[model samples]
Target: MARLRTLFTALTLSSLTHAYIAPISTPSTHIANNDDDDNSDTPLPLIIWHGLGDNYAADGLASVASLAETVNPGTLTYIIRLDDTASGDRSATFFGNITLQIEQVCEELAAHPILSTAPAVDALGFSQGGQLLRGYIERCNFPPVRSLVTFGSQHNGISEFQSCSATDWLCKGAQGILRSNTWSSFVQSRLVPAQYFRDPTQMEAYLEHSNFLADINNERVLKNQTYKKNLEKLERFVMYTFEDDTTVIPKETGWFSEVNGTEVTLLRDRAIYKEDWLGLRTLDEKGALKFEVTGGGHMTLDGELLAKVFSENYGVYGRPFDGQKETDYPREKEL
Candidate 1:
């Protein structure tokens, strides 16, 4: 029985790393705002990070960029990509060191011509990308985030891996690498998902061996207070969980952790929130931490939901993407 469970875990994690690879066109071109969009088009720019198996060039992402412009008219949109090419970026989702990738992201954002000087930017993250952006915020938020919205992200971490075929070579390879020791330095440094693979069942192992989630989630004994400080500055941190999500085991990882080991512990009741780890408690206190729910499986967002999500979260002065000026936006809307 134990062996069967291990095999299942290995295949699931393997496929999850490779799922979501979308079709792409031109992934690198930055969509300009509407012709009339200029410096005064928006008070804040927007940044996005896609989940694993996805490339910046995906048609869906480009449409998202175009949609941002239509919704906000002149909003600037930049989707963070780890690699220069679509294939490379997709490959990055499975390989490469997550810490290095995030550090590289920090440097890239700091070097951005406009982003470096912007007062703040609104951010949107998808799946694993959501946690990565949270890492960015904790590690180095040079251009701090005013608002952050994430969809179907494993924010807390995953114990049960996603589904993959038992016969897949790739899945078999992942089992070979992870089954013996997911805690080994090689696996932690190499496998992207392994970095955040927090098995609540093995609490000590997760805390001691987890390379990414532990640090970013501030679950380690030695905490980085800056992570808390930086995150607290956000005007709002919105999280959306897909109710029928099968891609992320125990899907509640999106709203933090759905369970601790085999026990279900709500976020508000967890120490991570009660103690203000990563400033989640602070954000919640100020009504900045929002827990929202949606229908469908992971990454199954429809047009109306996308429009509502974007329009409500990605605009200047914490306003929706509607054509209203910052001052003209209603104060009650922030709630």
Candidate 2:
């Protein structure tokens, strides 16, 4: 019995470290739109961002559009495209495009002569979209935004690629890209950490480009300074954690370092397990987590919550959050 218990403990810890698991999802071709062309006075645009290995046209846009209609009738839903559908694998190239999209949207809000001036927007991003937006906001001067919400974002950086065995294709591809000086440098500049380099020469080669990355792109986001700055300017902020979200490590202990060079916030184990939500992290000064919920782990949400958020019915859906207690996350304080 003692030996059996010991084996179980060992296995549990092993699995715990490897807990960040991504879900297999069905690719969606749905686009979100309003029936009428007339714009509303309040342009509460809801933008959706998908995760890594995810294409934007997925169910995310539909989900957010549904939510927007529920909360604010006739709200405009915009699909933030990562790349041109007619193009090739443009993962790295899409960074610049993503930045342009933000700027364009902000400009539209500013220049639209007829629309009544309103709040910036309610942006919802999942996985890589969230992390990418973090980089975008950190690099660009803060923009006007009402609410920023992220689901299963790996704010601290993902470690799963490091542990994958040599035989795994995912591990090989990620490793190959990180090992390449050109590729690794661009990735690191965005405050993204590369994991598992068994070869010293290869690691050194990548580090050679680190200086430029740190000076150029990383200087602003090191401690999440930019993120902190924007947090103060924004109206509301929300982060949703999918408890069993494989993309995010749902740990109960340990403190990971912040993005090197920038005070980008570090990830602590307690912050993960004790968090109101499974994967939500602490915000910079002036920023608050607001609320966190566990349960329907990973990308699944209840139909009712979806209807409540999007303001439309999707039949009887799975509960969006687990059985955790709810907390208010309103940005405005009553006078």
Candidate 3:
């Protein structure tokens, strides 16, 4: 009986050892390979600029980064955080000078090691961030950007409030406040005023001073070839907006509209046919400019939609664990 008990004890110990060793070996192999792969594979880097009054660590920015990662596991997203204090005591970021913001972006790109490499990096900008990026690319010209994707951006300045309804009391009140000569003059006095909401007629005077949209659009400095060349370098210039985007009214501004007419659903009608003031028509002619109109509202985008856009325009695709060749994901019609 003692001999039998000893044999059973030895078998129990052997079983325990095997169980422990088996699990350990699998994880160890996986960890080593994962570490090696992470070190060897350089991820495709992308810079993200958040909307007004948002920070680099904002939840929306995180969601965008996660969505990008889902589509391409190799994406490395960097969010550019601006100085929130620049707007004075109000701490309003939109009120902050866009030229200074562009400078910050340039500084960040110039400093990043991976972003400074040969193949140009991509960028995703939202709202005011989008306009800021446009300004940056047109002016800075260093640190090449391969593609730019903007959401609800006011590229040509938002003029929706200019046409406020006479019947709608709320709209009238808001427009009255913004259009007041005193208020407009006060905004003009500010370091970097919100150019989008400014009246087109008064834009010339603001442009002469410190208006960001005016300077970047080359409204006064049209003779600068470098600005045009810099804009032409972008491989893809994609803009997104919805039919009911009230914030960026006259949504054509998002695509750099040459003429302001009735709203159109199709991309062809919305696009600028002639070489307008913004020079984006050249990009359109090269097939680099793309406009995506969705049924959703402002700042609305999901992983599926983002994946489709990236795959169609940027050649980004999914990578399955089975080690198969990555293919372009089919575009969804519902977006």
Candidates in order, TM-scores: namely 0.83, 0.53, 0.68
Candidate 1, position 258, lDDT: 49
Candidate 3 residue lDDT tens string, 236-322: 788876555554565556656532354323333332234444556676666677766666555555555666654444323211122
Q: In candidate 1, which residue pairs get closer than 3 Å at backbone N, Cα or C atoms, i.e. clash?
A: 12-162, 27-57
Q: Which candidate wins on TM-score?
A: 1
The model with the greater TM-score, 1 or 2, is 1
- Model 1 per-residue lDDT tens digits across residues 13-63: 455433463333222433433323343547478898988778888887887
Q: Candidate 3 regions off by >4 Å?
A: 1-43, 84-92, 161-177, 181-186, 189-193, 201-210, 258-278, 315-335
Give the lDDT of residue 296 in candidate 2. Answer: 48
User: Whole-model lDDT for model 2 versus the true structure?
Assistant: 0.40
Ranking by TM-score: 1, 3, 2
Which of 1 and 3 is the better model by lDDT? 1
Residue-level lDDT tens digits of model 2 in 1-335: 34422332332223222222233222243223232244343446565555544454444446555555544565666545545561221232223333444455445434654322434545666654665554444455223445566666554444333334556554444444444533343343432223211122333443344422222222222343454455455434455555454434421001222333322333332333234121234342233333444454555555444444332211111212222322432221110
| Candidate 1 stretches greater than 4 Å from native | 1-43, 166-173, 318-335
Compared with the true structure, model 3 gives a TM-score of: 0.68
Our tally of clashes for model 2 stands at 21
Better of 2 and 3 by lDDT: 3
